[model samples]
Target: MTELNLELTKEIELLRLVTVGSVDDGKSTLIGRLLVDTKGAFEDQLLAVRKKKGETKIASAAEIDLAMLTDGLSAEREQGITIDVAYRYFATPKRKFIMADCPGHEQYTRNMVTGASTASAAIILIDARNGVMPQTKRHTHILSLLGMPHLIVAINKMDMVDHDQATFERIRQDITDYCAMQGIKDLICIPMSALNGDMVAVRGENMPWYDGPTLLETFESLPVLGQLDEQAFRFPVQLVNRPQTADLPDYRGFMGTIASGTVKVGDKVMVLPTGKSSTVKEIVMFDGNLDEAFAPQSVTITLTDEIDISRGDMLVRGDSMLEPQKEITANVCWIGDEPLEPRKKYWMKHTTNTLKAMVTDIDFKTDIHSLEHEQSDQLAMNEIGQIQLKLLKPIYADTYANNRATGSFILIDGFTNNTVGAGMII
Candidate 1:
């Protein structure tokens, strides 16, 4: 990690992308190819892959299964399907990237949602031969519903189609038309063969008719990060770092990750729920004092006037403080074996705040393939629905589409303490 200079301008760009497709659409292979072709893989792993390339019956000659990079679990290797979101990091001279390889199985949609929730771009894979399937429609609708700003439609396995221009064109049009219906206008299409490394990280001569930049080239060109809204300064306290002793005996500090915006010394801020006011006395990081701190950075803060503050509390610029609400309407993706029952109590974890909440009412269930909503009483596995939640105590939050950190949360079962649902605030 590069150190943030106190006097220099910080203009770094970070890109978060998610890859999605049905099983065997080569999602993992594509990521593997990108990493390996870009020299991101370590020497030992590359050598081991080369040695094991043609030893198995399922393995084809010159066909390196890139899934090996992320399928670290023995069961995943044996099953040959991604069950969770595996993250990998890579960088080029122009930009840095964090890629999330989301699973394609219908049963693992929750994991896919978890992976793609924070992504700025999504790569939706389509088998050239299969063209468009139900899962393709499902994921496309998901990307749109989530309001992802950008998308890449990868027509994979072009080798199976003999790299035919007509076939690629047909599939591209199919996806284009479908995405158009879902209001996804910013979409890019590319034809590539993940196994042979054609038009993935490096452009290949196999598809001369296709005249777009290779996948990696396009990734390098896409605008990486977005600026956090400077209009508001919001920070949620995560911990109170007070080690009471001589040097810092009277220290009363609130520490947490910046949920959004920026904070600096002497800024007038308001502590939520309690509605107390204070001025920023000091901004602190692990190394030393900071003149200012921005979104996503973890830091400790001291107020000019000490006021009662604790975990789950929010701090914001006086004029930007959001009103706390007891009831909320949120979009939830049901992920557990049991259906989401009405009036059932569950744990809601939003940023640093955790509260007991109950299912107040079911609004409607969305058809992932159709992007249509139908009134429903309950949400089943892999179902996306809008529902109302009544919390035991008021919690500060924002719409998921507006703020990623404050708008998202997980639903956990109290008895088992297992995450049963993933929710995005409406």
Candidate 2:
């Protein structure tokens, strides 16, 4: 197909974004305000928020409290704090959105990490009263290290600072320098008040000095992602279908979501870690067979040769450059209460494969506040550091920067079987 044809047929995607910051940075309120202004909130919900006005900080007498649109939990409403990730889906004319309103407290940092893991962009809220606190720096580092492509430092609650121009610019400069140090290029800083609805969903004329896109405008105008489809094909086998019945005794199908690139009938494919080669015989889905398949499509495939394959095996183009290896160096985030120390054992799960692994060495940990790499013997809870690991079995992997789905892994506790940490292969 021609490039024009491909572009014409390109799929539009729902933008997934997470809002994060320190306590009282208005992560929930920003989402609530957006929902209210865009008519995403229901009349009943608005009535409920208005009934709880005695507990709310929004000073508007006639307006319903926007914070009530989120903070749905009873405990959250009573305490006026967000404890979990509150999700709200709303759409504008240009693009649909799935927003995760992550908790800002220090203890819920793990939950915050989970919210932003799959997001393409992040809106880091900064209270105009409290600029660039430790949590602000920490969340920024977390988002940047997680490979979030776009970062919008939403300096929220500008009303508290009397919409001071100096307050906005100083925070912008500080965040810009910090993002640059982390090697993040796509950073946008916006001034807004989530409570008063200024520069959020609507242009509240209060901030006439600020000349930039509103939050809704930013969401609508941002480009979509199609780079994964252009890369090498990666299909991690999730399951093997072998309905050996009387009617179809010889049928065997490999099933999984395509992680990247495209494959079609007759393409030469290779099963990873076992060097078995085959040709694509058929691409089957619930409906029917497809002439071709690309990234993120779930399909069952039948290969020309019945090679030994199972769940956790990766299928790729024969000439694809991804390598399978046993020992890989990775930047790891230690999420467990215990430290990630040398000689510790954990189950390292990459893609669909899981195996025993040992912490071999500690390279260094980043100081979020300063963006400095400090040598460390161990990484404690919520600490991010580079580490070496010895895997008991070989697996196909790539750098996190190259292919997100294939290059990331998680460490599970041997005793509790809990996810203790996340690893990005370097």
Candidate 3:
């Protein structure tokens, strides 16, 4: 492997993206083409794919079955359909990419969400021949709901359409008209043929009229999302670090990943749910002690006072004064097989905290196709709806739009111990 691919530098930022759309839209193949064109695929992997293609007669003699590179599961290979999200990692000289090849089938929509929840961008594939299917809207809606910063619509199979500019325009125009009503402006559409290796990683010569940088270029150009360092400081206490030894006798450190903003040695911080205040005495890291810490960095904090704190408790800026909330109306995506009924008790786990909560009311569910609110008594699997919940314990929370890490939660069924729903505080 090249040094650029192997070496993860502090300067080289990670960009995470997820591929979503209808089945047979070539999501896996597009990812494979990217890996192959960029030398991301190993020679042994290519040989294995070539061998499989010949043995199973899955592809023509000359055509490379690029989908084989990502559809690694035996069932995925046999069925020729992606049932689970497949992740592929590849790095360019400029950036490192973690691309999730999410299943396009409607049944696997939950799995698609699981992949996309952490993505900085979502590549929603649309077959040029199909234009914009309902599945396209479903995935788009999910992306918007999850606050995905970028949406790159890959209109694939341009080769099948003879690389016609008019066909591409029509599909693009239709999508434009559809999304215009939604008032979402983060979307960018690109015409490409993942199967024929057009406009994916390489600049194919077939389409003389379609002038645009390849998909790889577009990915490299995305601005970093979530300036957490600028936001208010939030650190949920996950562990009470107290390693007692001869050298250091009385060390009491609070350990957790910072949810947002920065913290210094003398910052006045407040513990949530208890309202106890303390000054940050020191910042402890794996390497050594640090003078400062920032969002998303896991570190241990020593407070000036031995304050009452435990797991699930949060530490934040005393000046921010974020109120602990108990009753909240939030948008929820029901991901379980069982329906989410009103007044039903479920364990609501948010960040490091888990508490018994009840869905007080089922406000309305979104008709993902129509993009309209529909009356619903309960939320079914793969359904997105508005719900009011009452938590057994109040949590220091923020709106998901403000801080994704602090606002999002999951519903666990007590009996089955299954995560049944995902919620975002509005």
Candidate 4:
């Protein structure tokens, strides 16, 4: 490729986003509309959707089951509700997007968390007629707690409310007030009818009084947060490469993705849980060697000194003051079918490290309805609470607020080996 083509490819940034809201709030329809309007959907896919039986139509246009575009499962279509998270990919001239259509039912909140966990921004749909419902508040609270950088409250189904300005303003105020209470920082409210395409990909004439960027415009313009190179260096060693071949007998390289920050040749680094210091000798890749590498990039590095590093060991800056701790308190969202009880053991997987851990105590459970803290001894399914954990071995970490890559973990049930909970270090 030419230099200009390479630069253009680098400039086309990818945005990871999630759609969340109460049941029947048009989450699926909005995504389908985006795909259709952006020309992201294939002709065969549109043809398949047209064959599905549904009374729903976008605005007053020809009959098209837009929700069927994302609701791929038979169960979801039969029940007329989303159950599992459905992912869709689309692109415009300015940007590319990977959107997750999350379930809205309260029982499937865990699925919503799974979708929102890695998203940079979220589009929360609120039915204009219902305003802010309980499920909407619950999803908002979860998003805020997860430290979502951007939130777009799409007031959907404006056509059903006669495109009334008063109704839009009232609902917008309610969402604004609630988000403030949750301590959300960046937020924007847009009045849109996903079914009619107003304020979505195009600004239909239905709500000309409300002037703002269309949903696609806002998505293309929102500042992308969490630049990994700006944070402290964190490289969790996933493997130690050693080829005993005669041509390259002494080759020893530490291989892993840069979880956060940057690393370059000759940079002094330290191995965690061992405190062995070394200097980077080479940054190796399949194409060739690089002078430096940053977060989210998987590469191999041969250090100047070999200090017996292995999997689960993390490499940091030589002068780093990060300490490994066996005990930690974290905010956890329980997702398992069984209730989480104190003194129960589970496997805790943080970054590339996994070890036995036990829940020591449940600090308090959060009431999603009122945003109140209530004392509790155990956490049930879809419940959020603060809890204490003791690990079998120490691991280097940072607070989730400071660095999500190294601070978040998942708990696996010992018997079933299923991921039962997700936690963020406090």
List clash counts for every candidate, in order: 0, 0, 0, 0
Badly placed stretches (over 4 Å) of model 2 are: 1-12, 51-69, 72-81, 129-131, 160-167, 208-211
Displacement of residue 93 (Cα, Å) in model 2 is 3.6
Question: Compared with the true structure, what per-residue lDDT tens digits does model 2 show for residues 1-426?
Answer: 122344433544578888886446776667777776666666666767774544434334236655666768888789887677878887665567888877777545576678887777889888888888877788878887788878888998899999999999999988888788878899888899888888887778889998899998898767656387898899999999999999989899999999989999999999987888999999998888998999888999999997999999999997885676878899887779888898999999889888999999998988756768999899988788899999998888978888889989999999988999989998
Most lDDT-accurate candidate = 4
TM-scores for candidates 1 onward, in order = 0.88, 0.88, 0.91, 0.92
The RMSD (Cα, Å) of candidate 3 is 2.9
Worst 10 residues of 2 by lDDT: 1-10
Task: Compute the lDDT for candidate 2.
Answer: 0.82
Q: lDDT by residue for model 4 over 306-381, one digit each (tens)?
A: 6899999999997655887899999999999998999999999999999999999999999878879999988999
lDDT of each: 0.82, 0.82, 0.83, 0.86
For model 2, give the RMSD to the true fold: 5.0
Model 1 quality (TM-score): 0.88
lDDT of 3 at 413: 98
By TM-score, the better pick of 1 and 3 is 3
Candidate 3 lDDT over 1-426, as tens digits, reads 355544455577788988886548877678777887677777667767774444533332124566676678898889887677878888777778998877777555587778988888889889998899887887777787887878888999998888889998998888777666555577787899887778887778888887877799888888755577889998999999877988778888999999989999999999998898999998987788999889778999999998879999999888887887889989998888899999899999998999999999988999877879999998899888999999898888999888889989999999999999989999
* Best of the two (3, 4) by lDDT: 4
| Tens digit per residue, CA lDDT, model 1, 87-140 | 888766556789988877746578778878888899999989999888888888
Instruction: Give the Å shift of residue 227 in candidate 3.
Output: 2.1
- The parts of candidate 4 lying over 4 Å away from their true place are 1-11, 51-62
Measured with C-alpha atoms, the lDDT of residue 409 in candidate 3 is 93
